[model samples]
Target: VSCIARHISLTVGCCWLDGENQPHMKAVFPTEKAVHDHFENLLRILSYEPLYAQIRIKRSNDETVLVGSSLIYFLFIVQMRNMDWLSDLNTTLKNTMVSIIDASINDEVAMCCYGVLCEILTDEESKDLSISDNICNYFLQMLEDIWNKTKKKYEHVPIMMLLKGFQTLSKNDSMQQETAVSNRIHIFIEICDEYPIAYDVIWALSFNKDIQQQLRSDSPFICKLTQLSRQPENEQMSKIIDGILWNLEINHENRSMTDKHNTKEFDIMISYSHKEKVLCKQIYEELIKAGYRVWIDFDQMHGNVMDAMAQAIEQSNTVIMCMSEQYRKSNYCRAEAQYAFQRERKIVPILLQKQYKPDGWLLFIIGQLLYVDFNKYEFSRAMQMLHNELKVELMAETHTAPVRPKEDSVVAHSTTYISPPEVLRSSIVSENILDWTQSQVQDWLLGHNLRQLSRLFAACDGRSLLYLSKYMKNCEPQQILDLLEADSVRRLNESISLIELSSFHSVMHEKKKRLPSMYSSNT
Candidate 1:
């Protein structure tokens, strides 16, 4: 019986591969009975200590090892397709797969191991499998090793696999809380600079507010994003980078507003069924953290429910319907949608559940409109899509008046126009200050007084400050109290006149013109 089972397993493994390096294809089982029998035999063999021991010894031989590894890889591929199979896998089978991942010399075998591990960790149905912090760390280390080996070969398959694994792992809140996972995410962002395939992984990591905060604090990562944004060929990458930057900027602005007095209207109103409040609240928190002023019933405890809901939908610039089966059934949610529609507000439909489809009245209202799929990508990627949409709407609504500043005010003079020091100070103090590109800073500082420009240049380091000075020819200034360190920022408390600086420059230019002629005549 043992000999026959081993032969059948090898045959099944070979058929599973289907002569392809990739293991995504279906196994060529001879019959329905054969498929059931093959898995039944696999479970029995993997559970039996004596049989598994014999298989391990056989795996030592070169020819037997290849077949044995293929068999294990095949099992993983099967498990990925049918997560129910994982319920039958005992500790012995799980450990065997982990061992194969740890000990495998072949990249393809390792990739398969990681793929299965990801499936077990991420799939909702496979939650029985134990995935400890140490195990997660081991998987991340293995992924890094594979990334270093395969990144140069233009083999994005392994990196993509690893990213999928990371994305799956991130879905678990416990795994996300692990310090090791957080460090891995940071390292992965660095890897993204070399491998564009890892960008999606970065996007997944960004969904976690903690990870986003970490990225915001990381100067090098922000610099990498800024550099990538300048590459016209990297349009998709640029879009992701822009979304992250926009989120960071908006959050900063929102925090600043919150700290001070913010009288601005809500950017969005969230409507959903009370039954789906958990998901709605999660979306609400994410939106608020991303910097949008969101109005939801959770924050409106003091108001009349119907009246407040109507007022919120009417006042908000956009209404986001958290579309789900429950939402469709809710009368209140429908009323909010109708009011937003009647008010001619921009209504963004977001599909909250994987199985949710708009139907009947809800379908009539939102069916014609394009919606962002929260279930399609990882949460952060979907949030980014929604954010990009909101950003576009916000940009469209931003209309600057043609009114000019008074002549005596700083804005009247091209060279002496100083922005409120408080505004510049706030930007300089922001965690995302480094995210500002050179061109953006230049644009902001344009037409400022020479001394203020000098002070600004002094705040930056050597080369950048020198480069900025070129734009300061018609600039303004406030005296620098102290020279700032390369990485430090200090607010200028006092303002000074640009008249002295401008006169000094004029005198210097006059002297320079006469000096050349004077030297020539003397010679």
Candidate 2:
């Protein structure tokens, strides 16, 4: 019986029951009855537990151990595929799994026990079992054990499963104490070299606000992670480091942030990543020399910095976003852009990444605004265009009265009349997308959930938008965004006399790609 159970478990569990593939597999084969049938058969097999499970007596060692190990794999994988199965499991079966973990002396049986425990305890809604101090301590103890075995080649699968439960488990009272959270953080760091997934565990832990605050207070810990980010082993590792750094920024000592939200602020508020500090500083210097008051957080802000940013935005007239992949990744930067957008403040985005463009939340925030691409234009020219959009008058057309023929001119004296070319008015909203005035584009954006981006479309009619969609059909999502941004600024230059260059929304062009092929036929 044990030999048969082991063979069935190996074929079914390893080949047919990988957790990640189950969701799509179930969707394709919508026969839930098949899984229910498997569940019934598995429970009947578990009904015949060894004598040791009932009376604490030793059984025929290897045979019973193999059967028990294979049975628990069945439980774990089934629970993964149908999570509700764990909650439906009876109280006796639940205790049996935990009991196996508590008593198993063999490493194979112990690993299977950990796997089942991970499936069971990770779900907080499992009414039969909630995590306690014992369970939390067990995960920490096992992680410590893994770290302590210097020369042993132990399985890292159990460690990963334990971290999954520990992640959800850390939210309850069992992990409320600072020391418990801190210890897990340390152990994850220690084991990260051998088990690189350990870094992911630490990153996940940072999502809890309280734990994020705790990590921020530990200056040395934040400093160490920052150093690690500088020399990441790979792109995935680089993203992990960026995510951690984005979450737990540094805390400057001996300086409590004052209530500057109500105070007098600069005319232009500069929001950029510290990675672009040199460029940000130059922008700040030039703005200052031009006599425009500016706000750039020259001193790197660390902890609890959003409040002052809100206040600064409230008092500022213009916000200059020095955008890059790094800036978009920061929660702090996103918050600032979002708040500025919410207030309907004018935004001027200057792209900093070589080929990067915004997406998701960042994309929505800068959608309809004038985009200044530093990568495409020379520094002096980009700044000059930025100034023209701001109405600073560098190469800007000065509005003047139209020159008319003299009173005695021959055309003026003649009775013959002439007709001039007809131009579309900015206020007109066309039925066709191609003939659309920019103002109509603004109304279309406002009708959507995009209040942050409603300006800068006064001159971009349906043809401009259609061409933009066709031109960007093959480009990446990011490239399309940046290209459209540069195109928005180019449109702004033509309408500089009447343009305000105010900011936010960009989903329309992307949605345009999905339009019927007939829409392309009109042009």
Over the stretch 417-498, how does candidate 2's per-residue lDDT look in tens digits?
Answer: 1111011112335556776766465445444423323334434566775665556556686775665566655644323211
Give candidate 2 misplaced runs (Cα > 4 Å).
Answer: 12-40, 47-63, 71-96, 99-111, 122-131, 150-182, 207-221, 228-239, 251-523
Worst 10 residues of 1 by lDDT: 409-418
Q: Which candidate achieves the best TM-score against the true structure?
A: 2
Clashes per prediction? 13, 6
Instruction: Score each candidate by Cα lDDT.
Output: 0.51, 0.54
lDDT of 1 by residue, 91-125 (tens): 44556566654454554444555555654433232
Between which residue pairs do clashes occur in model 2?
A: 368-505, 433-462, 434-462, 438-457, 453-504, 453-505
